[model samples]
Target: EGDGAHGGFPADGVHRTSRLTAPPPVPPRSRLPRPRRGPLAIVVAVLLVLGVGTGVWYINSGQFTKVPPLLSKTEAQARDRLDEAGLDVGKVKHAYSDTVERGKVISTDPGVGDRIRKNDSVSLTVSDGPDTVKLPDVSGYRLDKARELLEDEGLEPGMVTKAFSGEVAKGFVISSKPGSGTTVRAGSAVALVVSKGSPVDVPDVTGDDPEDAKAELAEAGLKVRIADERVNSEYDSGQVARQTPDPGGRAAEGDTVTLTLSKGPRMIEVPDVVGDSVDDAKRKLEDAGFNVDEDRGLLGLFGDTVEKQSVDGGDTAPEGSTIKITIR
Candidate 1:
């Protein structure tokens, strides 16, 4: 064939080769738009499922029991009973009561014959019995006043006994058995010791030997002593010359009486203090070795002058003697 062509085609001009190329690949699935589950949608679906489960549990988990009457039962017993019945112990309150004993159950919250859910706490109210009060100090107070004091302390007066007491006045309380500042239950009895008038009476015992005199005075409920200074008297020496209050005189029991034994004479001349002012009379008698005592009559009370003397002027007596003067 000729090398030239009319359509300008190379016709086996030089041994040239043409090869076919591959087409473009398909797009990946990851590059296209995709459906999504956001945080809000996920949360809402989870909550809905949880709510349905909770409602089912709430409707089916209810188990109830009747609260048995725990009235008057001890706290331990009540707690044990409640626990056995699948219940819990709630608030425990205390109150004072007159009818119920102490440390006992008085009442209950939610009451008796009420239905309560299992593991529910039941309230308990316990009693403390009657209230307590401090024992008052009624010593030295009059009986009537002491009763009032006991009443004020919310206590009851127990026993009243009468006794003679030198320290406590008549018609007054000497002491209480439990004493003061003691705490006791309300309406508790308190034993009392009340005073009754004077103590005792003293008898006469004079002119006896010192030892013998003491014995006699002891029998008569009186105390005896010997004077420091002896005197000369008609009685024999070493014998009691005279005793205080003379003889057959009234003296308080256990009162000491001084016995002046004879040791020759030691007489003193009495001084006249009558018709003088009380101050002047006392001074004059004391200067003359005499003890001055006074007695004011009903009409002569608060008087400043002495009206009469126990011993007249110029009379003889013991050097140290008591001279009573009536004031007017």
Candidate 2:
């Protein structure tokens, strides 16, 4: 009725509705445009991919693989297996063991069932056979027989030396080098010293001149005697009388030869000097190489004249002897 005149009241038609008081036109409700999630969806998808990749890498790595056990296998066989599995073989050290064979594997570093990564190495202990054998006592045995025995024992016969031994018989072993009962590896050499026999003598020359005697004895492959005795004879005066390793006896070479010697002329007393001029007496006795003690002085019946001597006149004396004289 009102707007029918303006539409009813025209000019001041219904006081204008307050714009501030009217609720904003309800936003058009086109169903929220489907959420545009391009960046967010991409971020979530990347996270999922990373997680799956980590899981796959871990499974394919050897870190998660089980190592095989190989204690009973031969060294060669074990080495081949390790190589095939992308593992390496380390150095091999040898040791003596009663339960292991000469060249077989004694044991492994990580043992039978240890876990290890690829390209890792496993050390090995190999067998060098039982400890060395003790050499048997073989000295005094025949050389040929000893050699056979050594050969049977897997040892060698080294150099053989010939010697004359009193303790061991000829053609028999006297002793061995490297000694007996010493530990040695198979095929090791043993040196030998064999006895030839006891030595023998040549001859005896006890009455010959020293120089001549040495020559004669040497010529006969014998030795000489050296002896001392009293003698008046000129020929072979102080020479050997007896010998040993007697003339026909046996002895070693370089054996000592003994002998006796002759003691020269015995001494006698000097003659008396009474009534003889002291100077003349001195000259005579001194010319004979005698030692003289003089007693002549200026106080006697025959002043400075020799009156008495140690021994009477005409007494025998050694050619070169000492004499004492008393003068008045």
Q: What TM-score fits each model?
A: 0.36, 0.31
| Model 2, span 24-75: residue lDDT tens | 7887768776878798899889989987988887667635333456454667
Q: Compute the lDDT of residue 279 as modeled in candidate 2.
A: 84
Task: Give lDDT tens digits, candidate 1, residues 1-328.
Answer: 4767636667755555698798898877676677698999999999999999988876766466778889899999999989998999999999998888888899988787698888999999999998888899999899999999998888888889887777887788999978999988888888899886455554455556788888887887777778898877645568888888677765555567778887643578988888999999999998987888889979679788988999998897776678899999
Best candidate, lDDT-wise?
A: 1
**Candidate 1 Cα misplacement greater than 4 A, ranges:** 1-65, 69-91, 97-104, 110-121, 127-130, 200-328
**Model 1: what TM-score?**
0.36
How displaced is residue 315 in candidate 2, in Å? Answer: 99
